[model samples]
Target: MGKAAERFVVEGLVEQTPAGPRLIGSRCRGCGTTYFPQKASCPNPACTDKAPVAALLPDQGTLYSYTVQRYQPPPLFRMDGWEPYLLGLVDMGDGLQVMGMLTGVKEQEVRIGMTLQLVTEPLYCDDDGTAVLTYKFTPAGTAL
Candidate 1:
């Protein structure tokens, strides 16, 4: 068989660092605000500064909030085996909060103050046999 294709769900979102998988974001030089997906320009309209530098956020964070997605998401959002999944907003310190799926535990077991760590998991396989990966937050110390 040919080599299996491995790809990120969204390019430039996750990076393999010495510490572990960290989410990539942009920090504005003007307001010092950070954003995921790496914004090109600062969101603050008051500041005219155009410099936004890349930042790797901390992998471990606390669960700020969460909800269970019961319905199937539309196309382009690949959930191979659709089911209710837990999604949460994580506080990565420094005023940086990230929204991602929560794994490694049942939906009802999730709590507001639980500690979580970043992990890259397989979302789905493409027609070309490529494994599409996405970042998720699982209970700290759980194997990815």
Candidate 2:
């Protein structure tokens, strides 16, 4: 049988680059505000330009805050090996803060203001064996 194909959990949310995985977002040309998950228009009330262009967010950021998910997520969320995981809000500069699953570092070692890097890992496999991928943050300089 052929190897299982990999796919992102959500399309257009992240892109694989030569350097590494990068988040796909939108930036306002008028006020320079950035947003994740991409936006159709600028939501800033003070900015006049409503159009937003696609932007690749920084690959690294600092952990702004975090929490542990001790319980299983709702039915919509799926994981191959379910376990308690850490979730973090990372500050990616330009006033942009992104929330993503934290990996590599132990929950007890997690700390605010720790440097993190963007990475992709399989969350689960599909019925056909396709690997479902999701973005996650790891301690900067950690080998994947």
Candidate 3:
């Protein structure tokens, strides 16, 4: 068997650049608020300018919090290796906190406020041999 062709879990959610993978988001022109998964308009009630533009989120952040998933998720969610994993809420600055799977560190070793870098890994391989990729957070400096 060879390496499988890769595809993101959702299109337009992430992009590959010369630097690395970047999350596609939106920045509100009114209040300068940023959002992940990209929003079509600013949700802030105080802002008058509802226009939002596409933006790439930072690839690094601080681990604000985390939790362990001891049980397998619903059938809609698939993983190649079914095992308990850590989920983290990462603060990417500018008041943006994104939740994603934690990688490259054990649960006992994970620490709040630790630096983390954005990464993508295969969640599962489809029957057609496509590796479904999803964004994750790993300890900074960990080799990809």
What's each prediction's clash count? 0, 0, 0
Model 2 agreement with the true structure over 7-96: per-residue lDDT tens digits: 999899999988889999999988899999799999899999887999999999999999999999998999988999999999999999
Every model's Cα RMSD, please?
2.3, 1.8, 1.8
Candidate 1 per-residue C-alpha lDDT over 26-112 given as tens digits, one digit per residue, 9 for 90 to 100:
888877888886997887787788689999888899999999988888887887787889999999988878899999989878999
Best by TM-score: 2
Model 3, span 47-140: residue lDDT tens: 9999899999999999999999999989999999799999999999999999999999999999999999999888999999898999999999
Instruction: Tell me the TM-score of model 2.
Output: 0.96
The full ranking of all candidates by TM-score, starting with the best, is 2, 3, 1
Which candidate, 1 or 3, would have the higher TM-score against the true structure?
Answer: 3
Candidate 2 positional error at 20, Å: 0.6
Q: Model 1 segments beyond 4 Å from truth?
A: 1-3
Off by over 4 Å in 2: 1-3
Worst 10 residues of 1 by lDDT: 1-10
- Model 2 poorest 10 in a row by lDDT: 1-10
